[model samples]
Target: MNWNDLEKHFSSARLGRYRASCGGDEAKAATAYVNNMLLSEAMMPMLNVLEIALKNGIHRQLSTLYRRADWWEAWAGNPAFAWQTKEVVSAKAKLQRREETATTDKIVAELTFGFWSSLFNGSFQSVLWKDLRLVFPRCPKHQRQRHAISSALNQVRDLRNRVFHHEQLLWLTPSLLDLHTKGTEVIGWLDPKLVPWLARYDRLPASWDAFQPV
Candidate 1:
């Protein structure tokens, strides 16, 4: 298609508004950006599965450590732990509005990745990490400390949010492939079998290869 036709879809405002330095033919650059987004979309299903796995895995681990399903709620009384309190409050509100009865498992599942990721924040690093760190077997294998694992999860979380929000992924640092690998690795830490299970349906590798300019 010619420039005008391309602009009809990949409008300069849409394409150039965020990423101003797009090189080569503007149309081709926009096409590449669109293709990258399509690839990003394809990775979502695998990412969704990964998100659930991480959530459940961490929930189970923490529950076992605390020996209580409502363990997160205990932090509510602590004035210094406001962030953790907010997450617990949010989860409780979600459960109260559910038409179906909310089981502990369902309530835990409903919590956002941000909530789980928050457990790794420096504020809880001393208390929470002692128990939570035990769940991350793959971290030790990779020579990653708790901070490293937290950093990786936060990066993947950022990428996941960007993809879902329709934000630009092409400009992400460390490359999307690297980010996806970190996500898959985090999944493997939780459940070794889940890695191959996700691999069976993951379209990221091939889609990414296709997006590379021929």
Candidate 2:
């Protein structure tokens, strides 16, 4: 299809960055636009595995620390965890709306990635970090500080959001690659065994190599 057709279908606003990136070469812009989508598609599996590893790791640790499966219940009752409690309430409501019983597993599945990442924020550093830090068993003792883990989680979270939102990722190729590495590193920290399993399915590297000269 021609540039006009592409613009009409994708919207000029959406194609603006592509157009600019390719120096006004309509063909290149269209190629880049399609390539951007491919890159985004390639990223999903890695992000999916990373998020699952993170949430499950934290949940397992917290459960052991509290000696209960629904350890978030303790947080919900504590005034200091007001923000996290609000998220738990929202997750439960979402499950209820779906007519699914709000079991601990269901509630955990319903919670957003944002909710899980926010637990690493400074507000809960004192209360949750001590227990949460143990979630990363493979991470070196000296490198397992709350702030470092928080930064890594936030970076992956941002990249995940951008991909899910269908934002432009062509220009972010280098940084996106870095975040992908960081994400996989975090997964390894959670469980070294998971890295090889995740690598078996990951496609971002090949996708990036294909989108050369961008």
Best by lDDT: 2
lDDT of candidate 1 over 1-214, digit per residue (tens): 7656766886766666434645545666667667867877877866898788777777877788778987776666787678767876677688788764667777787778888887788777777887787767666555456787788789888988888877766556777777888888888777788889888889887787777541
User: Which runs of model 2 end up more than 4 angstroms from their true locations?
Assistant: none
C-alpha TM-score for every candidate:
0.85, 0.94
lDDT of 2: 0.87
Q: After superposition, how far is residue 53 of candidate 2 from its true place, in Å?
A: 1.3
Give per-residue CA lDDT, model 2, range 105-177, as digits (tens): 8877778899898988998888889999988989988879989998989888889999999998867754678
Q: Per-prediction RMSD in angstroms?
A: 2.8, 1.5
lDDT of each: 0.75, 0.87
For candidate 1, the per-residue lDDT at 129 reads 80
| Candidate 1 TM-score to native | 0.85
